[model samples]
Target: MSIKQRDANKNLEQTKSHLQSNHAIHHQAKKNLVQQPVTRFALFLLGTAATILGIYAIARHFSWWQLPYTSIAVIPTEAAQASLPPNINTNFVTAVVDRVGPAVVRIDAAKTVTNRLPDAFNDPFFRDFFGSQVPQPGRRTIRGAGSGFIISPNGRILTNAHVVDGADTVKVRLKDGRSFEGKVLGADPVTDVAVVQIQAQQLPTVKFGNSQQLQPGQWAIAIGNPLGLDNTVTTGIVSATGRSSSDVGIPDKRVNFIQTDAAINPGNSGGPLLNQQGEVIGMNTAIIGGAQGLGFAIPIHTAQRIADQLVARGRVEHAFLGIQMLTLTPEVKQQIASDPNSWLNVDEDRGVLVVRVVPDSPAAKAGLRVGDVIHKLNGQSVTEADAIRQAVENSAIGKDIRLELRRQGRTLNLAVRPGAFPTAQVE
Candidate 1:
């Protein structure tokens, strides 16, 4: 063989060996690249499982293992329902009515009312022409209905004076379907409180609450026979307290009334206004005409006070100073000063101004004349006329009351003895 052929043969063999080595290395690299992704996926799955197990252990430690898997529902028991708010249910009212219903009564009063003939019928020419044919006066019956509450076990009931006023017959009906003839023991028109006696035993009586502690926004429930409907119940909140009689348009009454939004019709006058505990707090009395949610009630304290007097003495004598007055304000003073025929001079403001002093009354006897501005009563400052009236009402009859007045820029102190309110005036 030639030397060139031998060299070529050797170079070919070396190239073939080099190619085989490169192919082996490329196959191993391809196999490793395919296995790398599988190993990474298995490691990721193991890490996720560990995280889930750790979370389960923490939940079991906190006793919240069932929180994510279980649903919870709340169920109220009887005690839970009872512990709920009062406004959520009418159970309070129902309880009150059930407790107090038996003591409430229906009062039906009847009176004989005579109708008189006109004056023209009595003329001489007409009488002569008619000659016993003239229309004669007719007699009729006036019937009224109201409500009352039993105060004593022996059938002593408290009601409004107007309920039995001029009544010839009074019939009382109870909840147990029993009726009785009621006799008026006494009636005080000033306080509008009356006591009726019925011969009975073992009667259900009412419990009275303190009206002086009453506040606005308290519950008020009224049970009455309004418009001839028996056992009518109404509910509302107390709108205000200590409302003057004048503020309620009942100047003749001498009561500090409890104002409520409860429904009060004609026949609800004497019914009991109860509190949440079923205690009598007031007496349903009056309501403003054509106004919604405006009703007034006499305080239970005042009603009981007057009722006691009526039962004990067959009458109530209210203390009277007999003076017509008004609260003095800057506008009133200015009006009086500007008027030519006011016939009075008011120099001070923010006091009760005596517009007129009744002749021969306790005020007049004590030299309390018109134009005097009453500044104080019994060492207490007085700004409203109702305050003076209340002071006089609180005073005993024939007892001296101290008065401080500003008359023509001079302050004077006087003592006046109150007199009994006249029955004729009340009638």
Candidate 2:
């Protein structure tokens, strides 16, 4: 009875174990099937995300798309650059010309000059021989052309004084082909600045920049009518600044010219010299004869200052001392002392030497002698003759100027009142 019971129990237990093993395998297979769908979905999502990121990278590298208010990080690849348009080149120079080209104008002046007969032709015997055939004094019209720029909307223009000096009529022509009759308000020969007014309104005017802030190597653009060419554009850099009048071989003019390499021709005078920002920094005035790349301009500040006075009073009052002076360098001093016929004696190697004093002039009345060596004027050292002239030009009429002089091994301080420059001298 025990052997039969043991065998039956063992078989039943083995059957139960086999059934349990099959159930466990089926449950694991179902679990794996369920997890496989979720894993495949996660992999699909990752692949889709990677594809989207790759497309965005390519588009951004090629600048194919852009977002609002966003800056693109350019890759600078050749393929990317090849896609850009060729006409997209706009630089600072073109921008300046487009902004400032309208204000530049052309000025034409006509003056009547009278021709005089020679003294021999006017002789009694010569006149009697050809009484009817003798050429009589006649008048002829002289015409000149130059450049100018409008400073005010009402057609107030600024040009070189020499352009309109003694002109019987002035004609101003704008870039848009509009012409106007110009009236010369005044012309100052000392500074070579003149103001012309026309009866027009709402004209384009130039924007003025501070010349005091100008430096070497800064961009200089000139817009003017050069050699009868209207609206000519030239570009160069400021070569130098603060060139004295004597340094430029124009001692009669009281201007500290701005030197530039910009091509300024005969008709370029009174044209605006512009900076990079299209603001006027100077007025083109002169060019060295037979020289390449050498041009001079009046600082806009000085021109404006003189122009203001001329506009207000129709004239400028420059102070004068009425003395011909020479800067006493070593060579000049030696020449003066070595001369046997000259009565003047110069003992100093430096200072301004007065060679002649006009009778009854400010220098004569101030007791300034011919041999006087002016060491200082108005508390400033004087080493160049231009310095004294500049000081006199800046001095107010009837204002006292302190002069430090060295005469005969003695230092003398004298206060002299400056007088108005004679109109005869300015002509």
Candidate 3:
């Protein structure tokens, strides 16, 4: 009986054991199915989040897409900015030209030149056959053109002395095409300034400016009839000031020219060299031949003073010291040193060397000797022959001039009263 019971119990236990194992396996399979779906959904969500983050980082780094919170102002390109005009007034030059262009006049001068026969042809035999008057010389009219400006309301005009010096008739043509016959009030060759009068009244006159106030690099405007071109305006800057007329080879003139770069041609003489304010600071007088940007003008102050004298008196008298001198240069000093018979012995190389002294003249009366080196005139150091010459001309006729000289390595001072320059004695 125990064996049978034991065997039944064992079979039942075995069946129970098999059913429990089956149930355990089925529960684990169901749990695995549920967790597999959850894991797949989480992996998909992580991949999507990672892709979105990568796209946002790329956009931020490259600025491919702008944020809504930012604002920027646009800037113009260089080309667009360069198209703007300068801050200064662009019409300044035009305004100055418009103001002074009308007062400038063109002068046409005609002179009768009589060509004479040779002295041999004027022998007594030929003179008798040609009828006692000796054959009359052929006469021809020489014509020249220049420029000038009105200085007074009564038709008084200012021009260069050379313009109408020997002219039989002088004609002035205005910018408005009205022509008038000009009468020579007076002409001073030493100053190269002259005044001509027309019949017209209430004419326009140029305003004079202070020539002493001119500075280098200041704007200069020149208005004149150059090469027969009427009312041509040229613009440039002041190159220099206080240039002597002899510096430009005008030996007879006693003018300190105002050097400018403004174009001045042959016909531009006596025209105005205006400042930026449209005031006449100078009178255009000469130009360096074959050189561009080399023009000179007489200072307005000098021209005005000379004009007043020529208008009041028939002639202007210049002061004379009566000495011929040369600037002491290294070459001149060497030449003087090499010459054994030269009365001049120059130890210093920077003064005016007096070469000749006119007998009984102011310089000779003052005891100025040949070979004496003039170091200073008054208080100014004399460096050039022209400087001393200009100083003499500018001094008062009766004024005493103190001359500092170096003779034989000794400094000497002498005083001289300048006399009137003889017109016939001028070389």
Candidate 4:
């Protein structure tokens, strides 16, 4: 009976153990499936977050999110950096100051005449607008200040036409602090370049650079005698180009000006507009309407040419074609006939149209007539009025050049000598 009971108990225990093992295996398999999915999902989220942070870091490093290209400068040139040498290639503006600072001068002009202002402003009618202004028409001493530059070593200064415009007595100052009486050599109101020669010789003369090559945002320096302050140097950059003064009474004019945001005051006129290379690229002449940092200068190419002529001959002998020209108009085409003369003497439209012919000018001498269309100067085609001016300016005085012209529907060749530019004071 003991043996039978032992066998049965052992079989029961074996069956229970087998069932427990199967259940344990099933539970382990279920736990593994759930844990594997959760682990994979957590790893994927961590990888995505790391990738986003990396991309953000790269974008911040590259500055791709900034303005593409609008021209705006950050800082103005330092004021106290006049001693450094200004080289065109150098980034430092101080180098430019050193180049032209020696040549820039101070002009102390005095018109010793009785004040010509009238006292009628003291009347109540004038007081309202002019604020109790008194016009002293009587004689009173009138003293004023201006700026100038020494173009030659022998103290020949270049100043504004207005500075010594009506000055009775003029005094020039050097950087070293010597003052000398100056006599006006010649002043051209059209170009605003004047030549004044002093007794001094071997003076520090500023070098000239080509303004035609000046680029906007390049460093610019204005060295002048501002407010009687000699050798005053200020800094800025080229703001604009090819500006016209048609609004300021000087209409029918073409000026390739260097615009700068430099701080230019009234007395800064006639100062040298220098490039970062410290070369005189232009002459500071006018500013826009009491505006701050809006200054304009005459291209040095124009100034130097005019100054050279004024100093040499006391006048600019602009060659005269003695003809009136108009931009190519539709009316001009109507005038041209289909059958132009044998010498290509047919009316060709486009470009400047000749309106009138002057009586004894070089053009008249060269047998040019009204209705003659000039297509090219030398060999290049003429497109604008500025092109003609620039071409004629580049020519030396009395240089014979060939012109290709269209007249009455005929193209012809005309040879003429360029004369000195004439001062055509706008009527």
The candidate with the higher lDDT, 1 or 4, is: 1
Question: What digit string (tens of lDDT, one per residue) describes model 3 on residues 1-427?
Answer: 6999999999999999999999999999878875897877987899999999999988877774564555353333343234335553335566666666778899999999999888977687886787766656798999999999998888999998998989999999998999999999999888889999999988888889999988999889999888989888999989999897778778667888899999899999989999877789998999888999999999999999999998889789889888888889899999988998886667878899888888888989999998899888897887898888877877899899999999988999999998998876652
> Which parts of model 1 are misplaced by more than 4 Å?
1-90, 118-126, 338-341
lDDT (0 to 1) per candidate? 0.89, 0.88, 0.86, 0.72
Model 1, position 360: C-alpha lDDT score: 88
Arrange candidates by TM-score, descending.
2, 1, 3, 4
Displacement of the residue 407 alpha carbon in candidate 2, Å = 0.8
Per-residue CA lDDT of model 2 for 392-426, tens digit only, reads: 87789999999999989999999989898887763
- Deviating ranges (above 4 Å) for candidate 3: 1-90, 125-136, 338-343
Which model, 2 or 4, shows the larger lDDT? 2
Query: Any residue pairs clashing in model 1, and if so which?
Result: none
Superposition error at 301 for model 2 (Å): 1.2
TM-scores of the candidates are 0.78, 0.78, 0.74, 0.59
**Candidate 2 residue-wise lDDT at 322:** 82
